[model samples]
Target: MKNEIIPYILANYPDLQTTKELLIHCHKLGIKYVELGIPFSDPSADGPVIQNAATKACINFNFDNLLAILLDLKKQNINLEITIMTYANPLYIYGISNFYTNFSSANVKGLLVPDIPFEERKVLTRKNHSIKNVWMISDNLPSASLKKIVSNSNFYLYLVAYLGTTGKNIQQSDSLKSTIAQVKKIKDIPVAIGFGIKDKNDVTNILNIADGAIIGTSLIIELDKSLNSAKEFLNNIIL
Candidate 1:
Protein backbone atom coordinates (compact mmCIF):
# COMPACT_ATOMS: atom_id res chain seq x y z
CA MET A 1 0.00 0.00 0.00
CA LYS A 2 2.83 2.42 0.74
CA ASN A 3 4.46 2.15 -2.67
CA GLU A 4 1.88 3.46 -5.12
CA ILE A 5 3.82 4.34 -8.27
CA ILE A 6 7.42 4.74 -9.34
CA PRO A 7 7.96 7.28 -12.11
CA TYR A 8 10.78 6.43 -14.53
CA ILE A 9 12.38 9.68 -15.73
CA LEU A 10 14.92 10.32 -18.42
CA ALA A 11 17.89 12.17 -17.01
CA ASN A 12 18.87 15.26 -19.01
CA TYR A 13 15.47 15.49 -20.62
CA PRO A 14 14.90 18.83 -22.32
CA ASP A 15 18.39 19.33 -20.84
CA LEU A 16 20.12 18.71 -17.52
CA GLN A 17 18.98 21.72 -15.49
CA THR A 18 15.29 21.25 -16.17
CA THR A 19 15.62 17.57 -15.42
CA LYS A 20 17.08 18.31 -11.96
CA GLU A 21 14.25 20.74 -11.23
CA LEU A 22 11.66 18.20 -12.30
CA LEU A 23 13.23 15.57 -10.02
CA ILE A 24 13.11 17.91 -7.02
CA HIS A 25 9.52 18.84 -7.86
CA CYS A 26 8.48 15.21 -7.91
CA HIS A 27 10.03 14.56 -4.51
CA LYS A 28 8.24 17.60 -3.12
CA LEU A 29 5.03 16.21 -4.59
CA GLY A 30 5.60 13.12 -2.38
CA ILE A 31 6.78 10.77 -5.08
CA LYS A 32 9.39 8.82 -3.16
CA TYR A 33 11.13 6.71 -5.80
CA VAL A 34 12.48 7.61 -9.26
CA GLU A 35 14.31 5.70 -11.96
CA LEU A 36 16.87 7.90 -13.81
CA GLY A 37 17.33 6.46 -17.28
CA ILE A 38 20.87 6.73 -18.62
CA PRO A 39 20.74 7.12 -22.37
CA PHE A 40 22.50 4.47 -24.44
CA SER A 41 23.27 4.16 -28.15
CA ASP A 42 20.65 1.47 -28.62
CA PRO A 43 17.60 2.04 -26.51
CA SER A 44 15.86 -0.68 -28.47
CA ALA A 45 13.88 -1.67 -25.39
CA ASP A 46 12.01 1.65 -25.58
CA GLY A 47 9.77 3.29 -28.17
CA PRO A 48 10.18 6.58 -30.06
CA VAL A 49 9.22 9.04 -27.31
CA ILE A 50 11.77 7.57 -24.93
CA GLN A 51 14.24 6.86 -27.74
CA ASN A 52 14.11 10.52 -28.82
CA ALA A 53 14.51 11.62 -25.24
CA ALA A 54 17.51 9.31 -25.01
CA THR A 55 18.97 10.83 -28.15
CA LYS A 56 18.59 14.27 -26.63
CA ALA A 57 19.95 13.10 -23.29
CA CYS A 58 22.98 11.40 -24.81
CA ILE A 59 24.34 14.85 -25.71
CA ASN A 60 24.95 15.67 -22.04
CA PHE A 61 25.25 12.25 -20.44
CA ASN A 62 28.46 12.80 -18.56
CA PHE A 63 28.49 10.07 -15.95
CA ASP A 64 30.58 11.79 -13.27
CA ASN A 65 28.99 15.19 -13.78
CA LEU A 66 25.50 13.71 -13.54
CA LEU A 67 26.50 11.98 -10.33
CA ALA A 68 27.78 15.36 -9.23
CA ILE A 69 24.29 16.73 -9.81
CA LEU A 70 22.88 14.04 -7.58
CA LEU A 71 25.58 14.79 -5.03
CA ASP A 72 24.62 18.47 -5.21
CA LEU A 73 20.98 17.58 -4.49
CA LYS A 74 22.13 15.48 -1.54
CA LYS A 75 23.94 18.49 -0.12
CA GLN A 76 20.73 20.49 -0.49
CA ASN A 77 18.94 17.71 1.41
CA ILE A 78 16.61 16.97 -1.48
CA ASN A 79 16.62 13.23 -1.14
CA LEU A 80 14.74 10.99 -3.56
CA GLU A 81 15.44 7.31 -4.03
CA ILE A 82 17.47 7.34 -7.25
CA THR A 83 18.19 4.37 -9.47
CA ILE A 84 20.24 4.28 -12.68
CA MET A 85 18.65 2.28 -15.47
CA THR A 86 20.86 1.40 -18.41
CA TYR A 87 22.35 -1.46 -20.35
CA ALA A 88 25.41 -3.48 -19.29
CA ASN A 89 27.75 -1.97 -21.88
CA PRO A 90 27.59 1.48 -20.34
CA LEU A 91 28.46 0.22 -16.89
CA TYR A 92 31.26 -1.91 -18.25
CA ILE A 93 32.53 1.05 -20.25
CA TYR A 94 32.25 3.16 -17.12
CA GLY A 95 34.60 0.59 -15.56
CA ILE A 96 32.91 -1.99 -13.38
CA SER A 97 35.71 -1.65 -10.84
CA ASN A 98 34.89 2.00 -10.21
CA PHE A 99 31.22 2.02 -11.17
CA TYR A 100 29.81 1.15 -7.75
CA THR A 101 32.26 3.47 -6.03
CA ASN A 102 31.14 6.43 -8.14
CA PHE A 103 27.47 5.52 -7.83
CA SER A 104 27.86 5.17 -4.06
CA SER A 105 29.51 8.56 -3.77
CA ALA A 106 26.47 10.08 -5.46
CA ASN A 107 24.07 8.29 -3.10
CA VAL A 108 22.46 6.21 -5.83
CA LYS A 109 20.05 3.79 -4.20
CA GLY A 110 19.60 1.17 -6.91
CA LEU A 111 20.39 -0.24 -10.36
CA LEU A 112 17.98 -1.60 -13.01
CA VAL A 113 20.16 -2.70 -15.90
CA PRO A 114 17.68 -4.27 -18.32
CA ASP A 115 20.24 -6.33 -20.13
CA ILE A 116 21.37 -8.27 -17.07
CA PRO A 117 19.48 -11.35 -16.02
CA PHE A 118 19.14 -12.65 -12.44
CA GLU A 119 21.74 -15.45 -12.53
CA GLU A 120 24.36 -12.99 -13.73
CA ARG A 121 23.39 -10.02 -11.49
CA LYS A 122 25.36 -11.20 -8.51
CA VAL A 123 28.57 -10.25 -10.30
CA LEU A 124 27.55 -6.60 -9.95
CA THR A 125 25.45 -6.73 -6.79
CA ARG A 126 28.06 -8.72 -4.94
CA LYS A 127 30.43 -5.81 -5.32
CA ASN A 128 28.07 -3.18 -3.94
CA HIS A 129 25.68 -3.78 -1.12
CA SER A 130 24.71 -0.12 -0.90
CA ILE A 131 22.63 -0.20 -4.07
CA LYS A 132 19.63 -2.45 -4.42
CA ASN A 133 19.62 -4.68 -7.49
CA VAL A 134 16.24 -4.73 -9.23
CA TRP A 135 15.32 -7.77 -11.32
CA MET A 136 13.13 -7.66 -14.43
CA ILE A 137 10.57 -10.22 -15.58
CA SER A 138 7.67 -10.54 -17.97
CA ASP A 139 4.53 -12.68 -17.68
CA ASN A 140 6.00 -15.63 -19.52
CA LEU A 141 9.36 -16.39 -17.85
CA PRO A 142 9.89 -20.01 -16.93
CA SER A 143 8.58 -20.88 -13.47
CA ALA A 144 12.06 -21.75 -12.18
CA SER A 145 13.56 -18.57 -13.62
CA LEU A 146 10.78 -16.47 -12.13
CA LYS A 147 11.17 -18.04 -8.68
CA LYS A 148 14.93 -17.54 -8.70
CA ILE A 149 14.68 -13.87 -9.60
CA VAL A 150 11.79 -13.24 -7.23
CA SER A 151 13.58 -14.99 -4.40
CA ASN A 152 16.68 -12.77 -4.52
CA SER A 153 14.66 -9.58 -4.62
CA ASN A 154 13.58 -8.24 -1.26
CA PHE A 155 13.44 -4.63 -2.38
CA TYR A 156 11.76 -4.37 -5.80
CA LEU A 157 11.15 -6.36 -8.97
CA TYR A 158 10.19 -4.93 -12.36
CA LEU A 159 7.29 -6.75 -14.02
CA VAL A 160 7.05 -5.93 -17.71
CA ALA A 161 3.28 -5.70 -18.28
CA TYR A 162 3.15 -6.62 -21.95
CA LEU A 163 5.27 -7.82 -24.85
CA GLY A 164 6.18 -4.58 -26.61
CA THR A 165 8.82 -1.91 -26.12
CA THR A 166 8.14 1.14 -23.91
CA GLY A 167 5.63 3.90 -25.09
CA LYS A 168 3.23 1.49 -26.69
CA ASN A 169 -0.32 1.75 -25.26
CA ILE A 170 -0.78 -1.95 -24.71
CA GLN A 171 -3.38 -2.79 -22.10
CA GLN A 172 -2.69 -5.14 -19.20
CA SER A 173 -2.74 -8.68 -20.41
CA ASP A 174 -5.13 -11.32 -19.01
CA SER A 175 -2.17 -13.22 -17.62
CA LEU A 176 -0.50 -10.31 -15.75
CA LYS A 177 -2.85 -10.32 -12.77
CA SER A 178 -2.07 -13.93 -11.97
CA THR A 179 1.63 -13.40 -12.68
CA ILE A 180 1.80 -10.54 -10.17
CA ALA A 181 -0.14 -12.50 -7.59
CA GLN A 182 2.12 -15.48 -8.00
CA VAL A 183 5.24 -13.34 -7.60
CA LYS A 184 3.77 -11.75 -4.49
CA LYS A 185 3.07 -15.15 -3.11
CA ILE A 186 6.67 -16.18 -3.77
CA LYS A 187 8.47 -13.01 -2.71
CA ASP A 188 7.96 -9.95 -0.48
CA ILE A 189 9.34 -7.04 -2.53
CA PRO A 190 7.14 -4.47 -4.26
CA VAL A 191 6.41 -5.42 -7.88
CA ALA A 192 6.30 -2.44 -10.25
CA ILE A 193 4.45 -3.06 -13.52
CA GLY A 194 5.65 -1.07 -16.53
CA PHE A 195 5.81 -0.75 -20.33
CA GLY A 196 2.44 0.43 -21.67
CA ILE A 197 0.34 1.80 -18.88
CA LYS A 198 -0.98 4.98 -20.62
CA ASP A 199 -3.53 6.69 -18.38
CA LYS A 200 -4.77 7.29 -14.85
CA ASN A 201 -7.16 4.37 -15.08
CA ASP A 202 -4.33 2.11 -16.19
CA VAL A 203 -2.24 3.28 -13.25
CA THR A 204 -5.12 2.68 -10.84
CA ASN A 205 -5.58 -0.82 -12.14
CA ILE A 206 -1.85 -1.52 -11.92
CA LEU A 207 -1.88 -0.41 -8.32
CA ASN A 208 -4.85 -2.62 -7.64
CA ILE A 209 -2.90 -5.66 -8.80
CA ALA A 210 0.68 -4.73 -7.97
CA ASP A 211 2.60 -2.68 -5.43
CA GLY A 212 3.64 -0.01 -7.93
CA ALA A 213 3.53 1.17 -11.52
CA ILE A 214 6.84 2.02 -13.19
CA ILE A 215 5.64 4.75 -15.53
CA GLY A 216 8.08 6.10 -18.14
CA THR A 217 7.05 6.98 -21.67
CA SER A 218 3.78 8.73 -20.81
CA LEU A 219 5.58 10.88 -18.24
CA ILE A 220 8.28 11.73 -20.81
CA ILE A 221 5.61 12.72 -23.34
CA GLU A 222 3.82 14.82 -20.71
CA LEU A 223 6.96 16.66 -19.65
CA ASP A 224 7.49 17.56 -23.28
CA LYS A 225 4.19 19.45 -23.18
CA SER A 226 5.36 21.51 -20.15
CA LEU A 227 6.58 20.86 -16.64
CA ASN A 228 3.23 22.04 -15.30
CA SER A 229 1.39 19.72 -17.64
CA ALA A 230 3.55 16.91 -16.37
CA LYS A 231 2.72 17.89 -12.78
CA GLU A 232 -0.96 18.01 -13.65
CA PHE A 233 -0.59 14.62 -15.31
CA LEU A 234 0.81 13.17 -12.09
CA ASN A 235 -2.06 14.76 -10.16
CA ASN A 236 -4.48 12.96 -12.41
CA ILE A 237 -2.99 9.52 -11.70
CA ILE A 238 -1.23 9.55 -8.33
CA LEU A 239 -3.97 9.93 -5.74
Candidate 2:
Protein backbone atom coordinates (compact mmCIF):
# COMPACT_ATOMS: atom_id res chain seq x y z
CA MET A 1 0.00 0.00 0.00
CA LYS A 2 1.08 3.61 -0.51
CA ASN A 3 2.07 5.79 2.41
CA GLU A 4 -1.34 6.79 3.78
CA ILE A 5 -1.73 10.43 4.65
CA ILE A 6 -5.00 10.28 6.56
CA PRO A 7 -6.73 13.51 7.44
CA TYR A 8 -9.50 13.45 10.03
CA ILE A 9 -12.65 15.56 9.80
CA LEU A 10 -15.31 16.07 12.41
CA ALA A 11 -18.58 15.71 10.50
CA ASN A 12 -21.17 18.49 10.41
CA TYR A 13 -18.64 21.00 11.64
CA PRO A 14 -20.03 24.29 10.50
CA ASP A 15 -22.00 22.21 7.98
CA LEU A 16 -21.77 19.06 5.89
CA GLN A 17 -21.18 20.88 2.62
CA THR A 18 -17.82 22.18 3.74
CA THR A 19 -16.94 18.76 5.14
CA LYS A 20 -17.68 17.07 1.82
CA GLU A 21 -15.68 19.66 -0.06
CA LEU A 22 -12.72 19.23 2.25
CA LEU A 23 -12.86 15.43 1.88
CA ILE A 24 -12.95 15.75 -1.91
CA HIS A 25 -10.02 18.08 -1.76
CA CYS A 26 -8.09 15.54 0.26
CA HIS A 27 -8.71 12.85 -2.30
CA LYS A 28 -7.66 15.13 -5.08
CA LEU A 29 -4.45 15.71 -3.22
CA GLY A 30 -3.76 11.95 -3.37
CA ILE A 31 -4.82 11.15 0.16
CA LYS A 32 -6.33 7.68 0.39
CA TYR A 33 -7.69 7.58 3.94
CA VAL A 34 -10.34 9.71 5.61
CA GLU A 35 -11.33 9.34 9.25
CA LEU A 36 -14.79 10.86 9.79
CA GLY A 37 -15.19 11.88 13.42
CA ILE A 38 -18.70 11.62 14.84
CA PRO A 39 -19.75 14.27 17.28
CA PHE A 40 -20.71 13.35 20.84
CA SER A 41 -21.76 15.22 23.97
CA ASP A 42 -18.75 14.16 26.02
CA PRO A 43 -15.61 14.04 23.96
CA SER A 44 -13.27 13.81 26.91
CA ALA A 45 -10.29 12.43 24.99
CA ASP A 46 -10.30 15.35 22.58
CA GLY A 47 -8.54 18.71 22.97
CA PRO A 48 -10.19 22.12 22.83
CA VAL A 49 -9.96 22.30 19.01
CA ILE A 50 -11.62 18.94 18.45
CA GLN A 51 -13.96 19.48 21.40
CA ASN A 52 -15.31 22.69 19.94
CA ALA A 53 -15.82 21.06 16.55
CA ALA A 54 -17.62 18.14 18.20
CA THR A 55 -19.93 20.50 20.09
CA LYS A 56 -21.13 22.07 16.86
CA ALA A 57 -21.07 18.78 14.98
CA CYS A 58 -23.22 16.97 17.54
CA ILE A 59 -26.23 19.06 16.62
CA ASN A 60 -26.19 17.76 13.03
CA PHE A 61 -24.60 14.34 13.41
CA ASN A 62 -26.87 11.34 13.95
CA PHE A 63 -27.28 7.81 12.63
CA ASP A 64 -29.39 8.94 9.72
CA ASN A 65 -27.19 11.89 8.92
CA LEU A 66 -24.06 9.75 9.02
CA LEU A 67 -25.49 7.14 6.68
CA ALA A 68 -26.74 9.80 4.32
CA ILE A 69 -23.35 11.47 4.18
CA LEU A 70 -21.52 8.18 3.54
CA LEU A 71 -23.98 7.23 0.85
CA ASP A 72 -23.55 10.61 -0.73
CA LEU A 73 -19.78 10.19 -0.78
CA LYS A 74 -20.13 6.79 -2.39
CA LYS A 75 -22.50 8.12 -5.04
CA GLN A 76 -20.11 10.92 -5.87
CA ASN A 77 -17.24 8.47 -6.31
CA ILE A 78 -15.18 9.90 -3.46
CA ASN A 79 -13.69 6.44 -3.26
CA LEU A 80 -11.36 6.40 -0.27
CA GLU A 81 -11.13 4.32 2.87
CA ILE A 82 -13.75 5.91 5.12
CA THR A 83 -13.43 5.26 8.84
CA ILE A 84 -15.83 6.38 11.57
CA MET A 85 -14.37 7.83 14.75
CA THR A 86 -16.82 8.28 17.58
CA TYR A 87 -17.27 7.59 21.25
CA ALA A 88 -18.91 4.38 22.49
CA ASN A 89 -22.04 6.13 23.68
CA PRO A 90 -23.07 7.12 20.16
CA LEU A 91 -22.55 3.62 18.84
CA TYR A 92 -24.41 1.93 21.71
CA ILE A 93 -27.39 4.27 21.45
CA TYR A 94 -27.50 3.96 17.67
CA GLY A 95 -27.60 0.18 18.12
CA ILE A 96 -24.22 -1.44 17.44
CA SER A 97 -25.63 -4.03 15.06
CA ASN A 98 -27.16 -1.43 12.80
CA PHE A 99 -24.20 0.93 12.91
CA TYR A 100 -21.53 -1.56 11.83
CA THR A 101 -23.60 -3.30 9.17
CA ASN A 102 -24.72 0.00 7.72
CA PHE A 103 -21.21 1.46 7.66
CA SER A 104 -19.90 -1.68 6.00
CA SER A 105 -22.48 -1.43 3.26
CA ALA A 106 -21.77 2.26 2.94
CA ASN A 107 -18.13 1.33 2.15
CA VAL A 108 -16.63 2.35 5.47
CA LYS A 109 -13.28 0.61 5.94
CA GLY A 110 -12.66 1.07 9.68
CA LEU A 111 -13.80 2.26 13.12
CA LEU A 112 -11.92 4.23 15.79
CA VAL A 113 -13.44 4.73 19.23
CA PRO A 114 -10.77 6.30 21.44
CA ASP A 115 -12.75 6.00 24.67
CA ILE A 116 -13.56 2.27 24.41
CA PRO A 117 -11.00 -0.04 25.90
CA PHE A 118 -10.09 -3.16 23.89
CA GLU A 119 -11.40 -5.54 26.58
CA GLU A 120 -14.95 -4.09 26.67
CA ARG A 121 -15.39 -3.59 22.92
CA LYS A 122 -16.91 -6.96 22.11
CA VAL A 123 -20.19 -5.56 20.84
CA LEU A 124 -18.50 -3.25 18.37
CA THR A 125 -16.36 -6.00 16.86
CA ARG A 126 -18.83 -8.89 17.03
CA LYS A 127 -20.87 -8.04 13.92
CA ASN A 128 -18.58 -9.34 11.13
CA HIS A 129 -19.05 -6.04 9.33
CA SER A 130 -15.51 -6.06 7.81
CA ILE A 131 -14.96 -2.64 9.29
CA LYS A 132 -11.60 -2.84 11.03
CA ASN A 133 -11.53 -1.80 14.70
CA VAL A 134 -8.66 0.65 15.21
CA TRP A 135 -7.09 0.79 18.67
CA MET A 136 -5.26 3.85 19.98
CA ILE A 137 -1.87 3.27 21.60
CA SER A 138 0.96 5.39 22.91
CA ASP A 139 4.62 5.06 23.90
CA ASN A 140 3.71 4.15 27.47
CA LEU A 141 1.70 0.96 26.82
CA PRO A 142 2.80 -2.00 28.89
CA SER A 143 4.64 -4.78 27.15
CA ALA A 144 1.81 -7.29 27.58
CA SER A 145 -0.93 -4.81 26.69
CA LEU A 146 0.90 -3.47 23.64
CA LYS A 147 1.50 -6.95 22.34
CA LYS A 148 -2.14 -7.87 22.90
CA ILE A 149 -3.42 -4.68 21.28
CA VAL A 150 -1.22 -5.12 18.22
CA SER A 151 -2.21 -8.77 17.91
CA ASN A 152 -5.91 -8.06 18.31
CA SER A 153 -6.14 -5.07 16.03
CA ASN A 154 -7.53 -5.80 12.55
CA PHE A 155 -5.98 -3.16 10.31
CA TYR A 156 -3.30 -0.64 11.25
CA LEU A 157 -2.57 0.27 14.86
CA TYR A 158 -3.08 3.93 15.89
CA LEU A 159 0.15 4.97 17.61
CA VAL A 160 -0.34 8.18 19.50
CA ALA A 161 2.68 10.55 19.15
CA TYR A 162 2.30 11.48 22.78
CA LEU A 163 0.06 10.87 25.76
CA GLY A 164 -2.30 13.76 25.30
CA THR A 165 -5.58 14.82 23.65
CA THR A 166 -6.17 15.24 19.89
CA GLY A 167 -4.40 18.59 19.53
CA LYS A 168 -1.05 19.87 20.88
CA ASN A 169 2.52 19.83 19.60
CA ILE A 170 4.56 17.09 21.23
CA GLN A 171 8.27 16.83 20.66
CA GLN A 172 9.66 13.59 19.34
CA SER A 173 11.07 11.31 21.98
CA ASP A 174 13.19 8.18 22.08
CA SER A 175 10.29 6.48 23.82
CA LEU A 176 8.00 7.18 20.83
CA LYS A 177 10.60 5.77 18.45
CA SER A 178 11.14 2.73 20.64
CA THR A 179 7.38 2.15 20.86
CA ILE A 180 6.86 2.12 17.09
CA ALA A 181 9.94 -0.03 16.59
CA GLN A 182 8.61 -2.56 19.07
CA VAL A 183 5.17 -2.56 17.47
CA LYS A 184 6.78 -3.20 14.09
CA LYS A 185 8.73 -6.10 15.55
CA ILE A 186 5.49 -7.67 16.85
CA LYS A 187 3.19 -7.02 13.88
CA ASP A 188 3.52 -6.79 10.10
CA ILE A 189 0.57 -4.49 9.50
CA PRO A 190 0.76 -0.73 9.05
CA VAL A 191 1.31 1.42 12.15
CA ALA A 192 -0.23 4.90 11.91
CA ILE A 193 0.52 7.75 14.32
CA GLY A 194 -1.74 10.60 15.40
CA PHE A 195 -2.17 13.24 18.11
CA GLY A 196 0.36 16.11 18.11
CA ILE A 197 1.16 15.62 14.44
CA LYS A 198 1.15 19.31 13.54
CA ASP A 199 3.28 19.96 10.45
CA LYS A 200 5.79 18.72 7.88
CA ASN A 201 8.49 18.13 10.46
CA ASP A 202 6.12 16.03 12.52
CA VAL A 203 4.92 14.00 9.54
CA THR A 204 8.42 13.54 8.17
CA ASN A 205 9.75 12.24 11.45
CA ILE A 206 6.74 9.96 12.02
CA LEU A 207 6.85 8.37 8.56
CA ASN A 208 10.38 7.19 9.31
CA ILE A 209 8.88 4.54 11.63
CA ALA A 210 5.17 4.60 10.79
CA ASP A 211 3.32 3.65 7.62
CA GLY A 212 1.08 6.70 7.89
CA ALA A 213 0.17 9.71 10.03
CA ILE A 214 -3.35 10.54 11.23
CA ILE A 215 -3.82 14.30 11.33
CA GLY A 216 -6.86 15.80 13.05
CA THR A 217 -6.71 19.02 15.05
CA SER A 218 -4.16 20.80 12.90
CA LEU A 219 -6.21 20.13 9.79
CA ILE A 220 -9.38 21.16 11.58
CA ILE A 221 -7.74 24.38 12.70
CA GLU A 222 -6.87 25.08 9.08
CA LEU A 223 -10.28 24.10 7.79
CA ASP A 224 -11.64 26.52 10.33
CA LYS A 225 -10.04 29.22 8.24
CA SER A 226 -11.35 27.99 4.85
CA LEU A 227 -11.73 24.75 2.88
CA ASN A 228 -8.55 25.48 0.96
CA SER A 229 -6.55 25.57 4.14
CA ALA A 230 -6.68 21.77 4.41
CA LYS A 231 -5.30 21.33 0.91
CA GLU A 232 -2.66 23.92 1.63
CA PHE A 233 -1.62 22.14 4.80
CA LEU A 234 -1.24 18.84 2.94
CA ASN A 235 0.91 20.47 0.28
CA ASN A 236 3.06 22.29 2.79
CA ILE A 237 3.45 19.24 5.02
CA ILE A 238 4.31 16.79 2.26
CA LEU A 239 6.64 19.07 0.35
Give candidate 1's TM-score: 0.93
- Would you estimate the TM-scores of all the predictions? 0.93, 0.94
Q: Which 10-residue window of candidate 2 scores lowest in summed lDDT?
A: 120-129
Give the per-residue lDDT digits (tens) of candidate 1, residues 91-130: 8788765767777667677888888888787557555347
Off by over 4 Å in 2: none
Best model per lDDT? 2
What lDDT does the true structure give each of the candidates? 0.81, 0.82
Collision pairs in model 2:
none
Residue-pair clashes per prediction, in order, are 0, 0
Instruction: Tell me how far the alpha carbon of residue 222 in candidate 2 is from the true structure, in angstroms, after superposition.
Output: 1.3
